[model samples]
Target: MSLRTVAVLLADQAAVFEFGVLHEVFGIDRTAQGVPAFDLRVCAEHPERPVNLLNGLSLNVPHGLEGLLGADLVAVPATELREFSPALLTALRDAHDAGAIVLSVCSGAFLLGAAGLLDGRECSAHWMNTVDLAAAYPLARVNGDVLFVDEGDIITSAGTAAGIDACLHLVRRELGATVATTIARRMVVPPQRDGGQRQFVDMPIPECTGDSLRDVLQWMSEHLETEQSVASLARRASMSERTFARRFVAEAGTTPAKWLVLQRVGRARELLEGSNLGIDQVASRSGFGSAALLRHHFTRTVGVPPSDYRRSFSRALSA
Candidate 1:
């Protein structure tokens, strides 16, 4: 399989990060490092038109659907799912039918679904949107748990970093492991993450209906570093242990232990992104008790090590 050319499809309200993922993987020239350079083209429905992103930025795309001609791969980045032109959708299906491997990132799967390209195919999307994707495309098998699903010719990936994983996997599959590794090293991501790598599920704190439960939730958030069991919490809330457990789950939609862990991880993210605290200090402040435990939960919850997350998201410290 010769992988030489890539066409990235963009639409109005495109996701900048997802588009950046494809551009990072195929647009950059790495021939100096022995990795093959791809003939990457950015395609839109209207050539030389301003393609808007949700973040108020826009790209002056130079190519239209015609740009997909003769491409080895066509990548669809996340964009607004409503009201895509019939011509553009036809171009997408035609590209796939013409033997170009088609890949979608994040909500981009919806475009493929709308194009009738995802019918009866196993796919993935941002976990938050998996239900909608499955509902809209009842014939498509949507696996919300995985980072991406590779169906030989069609690849559907979850949001953001998972797009990187899928693109790197494609590089490894068609180009070679060495080339993928070279690209990954330059992107500072794992060369070959398991396509089944878990997507990060954002668990926001649920609102409590009752005053007591609301106060307890606030207290728990404020004292995340301290160890507080159901019994102690029940006493503080003036309720029986069983009643407290039931009430907690009813209010939070999760068990007390699980909610506490989520809160701790959230706090850890805040500390990692905002402060210059070391790992051990972060663990202590976030109630993980030790750095090892913090690392385990942080990696599992956030899809990256705390250190890596910090490197990418942390604010610069003043010298």
Candidate 2:
């Protein structure tokens, strides 16, 4: 069935950021961008009841658990780790049994877990909570490192901003790239981020304050088409190879080689979504060397092959 209505469930002490992410993506009406409006509803366990928020504020949700019954997508934003009311759990399970796509952000996975919906499913949550989620829901396969995991029907995202990536992915998957890109453009965020990309970059070169590796990192991004190695990057940074490698990890939160592959994959995604380059050409431009190599890294990083990614996005634009 086509994705139309979206119901966001909020419980006690909901994290406003994750809830806002869902609202920003699914609740907004962006007809100007050729995106259809979603029937977005923020539901709580008690209709017209005030639900507390983390910031000491409260929200008066108008709908109750019944609101989830007909939703095409049911999103559970992060809430305090407490027992889910039986009504909410039943509604969630019923929504899943009825084939609605169920999604959770951060600790909201706990609600899905409580509903017994995450059993044996490959899921993810905030890194801080992954251990707890795993221990609590031993049957569920939990991965905390990636941005999000899309197991066809159920999608779970990591902390805060990763929710945006997962939501846009759902838009890109169900609606099309055009809608996702339009939403992302308005939001000033990337439409797609590889789900497998590490949650933390050692020093997070992009957010690095020190100037030590800044120049080298910028150069690498600008020249992804060229060969890059630790030795080459070290030379560019004017540091010894070992020093550069250590500093790179310290700042990037990942090894230089892994970081380089991620950069190439990111470039390939941009080319796939925005350009009409052939696989070989795209690979060459992104420094993947060959179509086979691109396919391997792209799939491993983005969770989909390049051709499939292009076709998915292209169809969105044409549609």
Best by TM-score: 1
Q: Each candidate: what lDDT?
A: 0.89, 0.87
What TM-score should be assigned to candidate 1?
Answer: 0.77
- Model 2 is weakest, by summed lDDT over 10 consecutive residues, at 200-209
**Alpha-carbon shift of residue 120 in model 2 (angstroms):** 0.5
Clash tally, candidates in order: 0, 9
Per-residue lDDT of 1-319 in model 2, one digit per residue for the tens?
6889999999898999999999999988898779998999889888666998898999999888888888999999988855877888998999899989999999999999999989999999998899999999999999988889999999999999989999999989998898889999999886788777656423233344467888787888899988888888898888999998999888877787788888888888778888877889999999999999999988777666888777655543454
- Candidate 1's C-alpha runs over 4 A off are 46-63, 188-192, 214-227, 250-253, 265-319
- Candidate 1: pairs in clash: none
Give the root-mean-square deviation of each candidate in angstroms: 4.1, 8.2
- Per-candidate TM-scores read 0.77, 0.65
Clashing pairs in 2: 201-252, 201-253, 202-251, 202-252, 202-253, 203-251, 203-252, 203-253, 204-251
lDDT of 1: 0.89
